[model samples]
Target chain A: MEQLEYEFDGAGSLRQSGPAVLVGVVSSGNLEVLVESAELGGRGRVVVNTSVRGFGEIWQAVLTDFAGRHNLANLLISINDAGATPAVVSLRLDQAAEEFYRGEP
Target chain B: MTTTSCGTAGQSYYEANALKRITSLLDPGSFHEIIRPEEKISSPHLRILGQPCSFNDGIIVGAGRLAGKKVLIAGQEGGFMGGAVGEVHGAKLTGLLQRATEEGPDGVLLLLESGGVRLHEANAGLIAVSEIIRSVLAARVAGVPVIGLIGGVYGCFGGMGIVARCCNALIISEEGRMGLSGPEVIETTMGVEEFDASDRALVWRTVGGKHRYLIGEVQRLVDDDVAAFRAAAIELLNDPRPLSLEELQKEHGMLSDRLKSCSSAYDAIDIWHTMGIAEPETLPLLDTAAFHKAVQHVYRGAA
Candidate 1:
C-alpha cells in the first residue's frame, strides 16, 4: 500500500453564503480547523489529497452532508488529515465553525 | 533557581542543552549521546524541499548515567527553525526509544521544544509522532519511566502535548507550557477576545507549569534555571517503579470521574482551592520549596 495520506479543501460554494474559511493543522489522530472568508465562485467545492486512496467519495458524501447541515456557504475549508476518524474530523470542523462565528457550542 | 554547573561546551542543540542540564547533576563525563547530530542522519524530505538539514535530523538521542543510574535522553532543538521534526528526525527518535524498551534506560528524558511537525516535511513529521507514541506504549509494556521535560521556547504544542500526556511521568519548568493549539493559532482561529494572543498570563494559565501541576498533568515543577531542572530530573529518574497498567487503568477511571464531575466553567484557581492550597493568588509567587510545601495535587497517582 502507498502512503495513506490525504488533503481535502471545500470552497464552501453553496447558495446560503457568508464569508468563512477553515484551515486545519495536519496532525495524526487529531487535527486543527480554521474556517474563514473566501472569494466567491468555486463555492461549495471540496478538494482532497491523501495518502489513503479510494476514500474520495466517502469524503465527498461526508463534506456535502456537513455543508448542507450547517447552511454554510461562501467559505473556504482546507484540511490536513492524518487518518483521523469521521468523528474527530466532524468535531474539529464543528469547533472551527463555532469559533468562526464566535458562536457558543 | 540555582544554575546547574555545565561541563560541556559547544553550540548545544536544545537537545544537548537538555542532556547537559540532566548530566550536570550526574557524575561529570558520564553523558553518552548516541546517534548524535555529528552523524549527519537527517531528513531527506527537507532535501526535496531545498531546506537545510540537521544531524540526528533535529532530534538528539543518547543514553547516559545520571546519579549512577543509566537513562535514555532525547531532545528536539527548536533553535533550528523552532526545532521542528521531519521524517528522518521522527524516525530516529521513534526507533531509538523503541530500542530503549529492550536496552532499557532507567528513564526517558525528552527535551521537548517543538511547535509540532515541520510543514516543509509534513507527512514524515506527522508519521514520526505516531511512531513515537507507539514507542511510548512499548516503554509502558516494559515498565520503564517516560518523561517530558518542557522548558525550551517551542513550549510543546500540537501532538507533542498528547505525547507529553502519554509520558509515564512529567517535569516542567515555570517557563514551559503545553497545549494543543498555540497562542497565535488560538488568536487566528478563535479571535482575540476569545483568547488574546499577547497576554502572557492567559497563555501561562492555559498551559503553563502552574496550571499543569494544578491539573495533575505535570508531576513535578522546577525553576527555569538549569540546575533546578537537573535536580528535578534526578528526583523523577530516581523513582524505581513507574505507573503500572493497573495504576493507569485506575487513573483513567479517575479521569472519567473528574470529567463527569467538573466540565463546566472550571477555572485553574478552582483547582488550587479544591486541592487545599492556602491561597490560589499566592501560588504563583511561591518559591519551589514553598509551592511544594503548600499545595496538593488533586490527582495523585500518575507517577
Candidate 2:
C-alpha cells in the first residue's frame, strides 16, 4: 500500500461548512472520498491511501487538477483507493465535493 | 458514477452500497452513523497484508428511525472484500446489537451481504461472527427484535448465514440468498459435479429467498425494491416477537419435523412437492406477487 499527501492553495473558502460528505466505496477499481471541514488556513490538504503502489505521481496530478477545479479551502480530503483509475478517482472527488457543498449531513 | 440519491421507492437494494442501503431503509434523514468515514475506524489487519481498507471497514452500524420508531441498523458492503467480516466490522455489529439489548429499541435491522469470514483475518473474523451471534440473541432475549434483511448482490453466507438465522425474523427478497457454504466455495472444495457454481438456476433453487421462504426459514418475502423492504420492516416492527423458551421449542419442533419429512428430498422442488404445493416447477418463473398467491395456501396449511 502507498500513502501520499499533498497540499494546495485554495481558490477561495467554502460557501458553507457542514458534516463530512463521503462518496464511493473502496472496491476493486474504485475508491472512497471523504471531504471534511477542517482548519486548513485557506488551503486544501489531500491524503490518499492506495492499495496499488507507485501511483504517487498520478495521484499528485489528479488531485492537483481536482483542487484547481474546485474551491477547497478549509477542507481536508481523504481517499481510500483500491486500484481505481484516474477517471474514477476524479469522479468520486467531484461527487464528494458536490455533496459537501450542498451541506448534506 | 452511481447517483447519490436518497433511498427512494424504486431503488434496487441489490445495487445500493452499504451506506445507501441504511439511508434508504431508515426514515429519510433519520440515520446517525456512529462511526463516520471521516473518523477512519478501518481494519488494522488489512494494511499489514497489503490489502485495501475501507474507511468504515465496509460495515455501517448506527442508530436510525424506521417509520418514526427508534432502531439500530447495520449494513455490510459486498463490493469490498466480498463484504467479509473482519475484526472491526464484526465488532461494530456486535456493539450495535449489545446496545440494542441495553436500550431496547423498536427493532434492530441487519442488512447482511457478506460471503463469510475474511480469509485475511480468519481467526478474528470467526470469533467476531460468534460474538455477533451472541449479541443478536442477547438483544432478542432483552425484548429487542433483531430483524435481518438479505437482498444484496453477495447474499449472506458462511458464518454470517448462521447469524441471519439467529435473528428473530428475516425479510428476504427473491434476489436474496442465504446459505452456509456459498456455491463457489462448495464448487471449489467439493468439485463442480457436487455443486455447480456456474448453474445460476440451480444455485437459486437451493439457497434463494423463495426456497427459504417456502421452507419457513424466513418470515417475509418481498420484491427487490427498497420501498418494499421498508414496508415489510415497518409491518414487522409493529409486531415484535420476543425470544422465549416456548418460541424456541416451537422452532425446534418445526425444524425437527421438517428434517423428518423432507430429508429424502433431493432438490427444492421435491421439498415443495412434499409440502403439497401443486405445480412446483412453475414457481421460479412467477413474479413476487404471483409467487405469494401461489404459496399462500401452502403457508396457511403449514401455519
Candidate 3:
C-alpha cells in the first residue's frame, strides 16, 4: 500500500463544475479517479491511495503528467488505484477530466 | 444501439458490463445512477486495508423506468473483485431497497453478478448482506416486487444467492450460474471426488440457468441478449408478484422434494434422467428455447 500527494499550479478551470465528478472502477489493472472543484489557490491537488505497494515514483510521474497535460485547475483530485499500470492510470485520469468538463449527465 | 443476428437491440446482456446492463434494461437514456462514480463514496473499510476502492463501490443503485413505470435498479460490476459485496456496496443496496419501501417503487430490479461477500471485509460484508435480505423482505411486504437478474461472468452465489432466492421472481439466462458455493470452493473444501470443479459441463449442470429452470428454481429463462432480458423484465414489471408466506412455503416444499429426489443422484445427467428429459447429456448444448421446450412437460413441485 502506498499514499502519495501532489499539487500542480494550473490555469484550467472547469466549465460548469458543481459536485465532484467520479469515473472508473477499482478492479485489478483498473482504477477510479474523483475530481472535485475546490479552492487550491489556482493550483490542483491530487491525493492517491492504492494497493500494490512500491510504485510511488510511477504514481507521481503519472499524476504529474496528467496535471501538466491538462488545463485542469481549481480542483482537488483523489484516486483509488488497484494494480493498474501507468498507462491505465493516465487513461482513467483523462477520462475523469473529460467527464468533469462535460458537466452533469 | 446495435442489432444482433437474433434481431435484439444493442449488445447481448451476457457481454455487457454492469453500467451497460443498467442502461439497456431500463428505458433508453432513462437510467440515472445515484452516488455515481463522481460522488466518490468509496468504502472506508477498504481504505484501511489499503485496497483500491471503486467510486460507486461496484454496485450501481438508482431509479429508472421500465415500461413507463418507476423501478429501482441495482447492477453489480462483476469485473471488480468478482462483484463481491462489501460494507459500502451492501449498504448502497440495502439503502436502495429501504428507499423503495418508503417511496414505493412499482418494482425493484437487481442485476446480480456476484461471488458474494467480500472476503477482504468479511464481517462487514456478511452483515450488510443480511441487512439487504431484511430490506428485500420489507420491500416485498410493502407490495413492491423485487426481481433478481443473474446473467454474467460471475453469476450470483453465496449470501447473494439466498437474496435472489428470496426475491418474488428471478430471471436467468443460459449463461448464468447460481449456487450456494462456487465450484472451486466446493472442490477445495469437499475434495475433487465429491465435486470436480474443473469439469465445466458438470459445474453448469449443477448451477446453470438450464438446470435451475428445469428444477423450477428460477421462474424465467431467457437468452443472453439484452433485449431478451429487457422484454422479460418489462413483462414481469407489468405483472409484479410480491413475495408471500404461501409462496415461501411452496418454495420450501419444492426444495424438500428436490432434496429427496436428488439425494441418490450423483450428477446432473441422473437428475435429467429422473426428470424424464431424453438424451440428458445434450441438454447443455441446446439453446434456451429448445431446452425449455424439452423440459416443459416435466412436472415440478412437491413430490
* Tens digits of per-residue lDDT for model 2, B166-280: 9888999999999999999999999988999999999998999999898888989999988899999898888877788888888888889899989999888999999888999
Better of 2 and 3 by DockQ: 2
Tens digits of per-residue lDDT for model 3, A1-105: 778888887874554356676677777888878888877767888888888878888877888899787866778888888888999989889988877777644
DockQ of 2: 0.88
Fraction of real interface contacts that model 1 preserves: 0.00
Where is model 1 more than 4 Å wrong at Cα? Answer: A1-105, B1-19, B22-26, B240-243, B274-278, B297-303
Candidate 3 stretches greater than 4 Å from native: A12-20, A103-105, B1-8, B299-303
TM-score of each: 0.66, 0.96, 0.90
Q: After superposition, how far is residue B128 of candidate 3 from its true place, in Å?
A: 1.6
**Deviation (Å) of B61 in candidate 1:** 0.7
Top-down DockQ ranking: 2, 3, 1
Query: Given candidate 3, what's the lDDT at residue B104?
Result: 96
lDDT per residue as tens, model 1, B47-166: 565444443455667777766778787877665546676788777778778878988878777778888777787777788888888898788678778877887767898877778888
Pairs of residues at least 3 apart in sequence or in different chains that clash in candidate 2: none
Point out the higher-scoring one by lDDT: 1 or 3.
3
Candidate 3 — which pairs collide?
A12-A71, A21-B38, A22-B37, A22-B38
For residues B135-232, write the lDDT of model 3, one tens digit per residue: 99999999999989999998999999999988888899989999999898899999999899889888888999888877877878999988888888
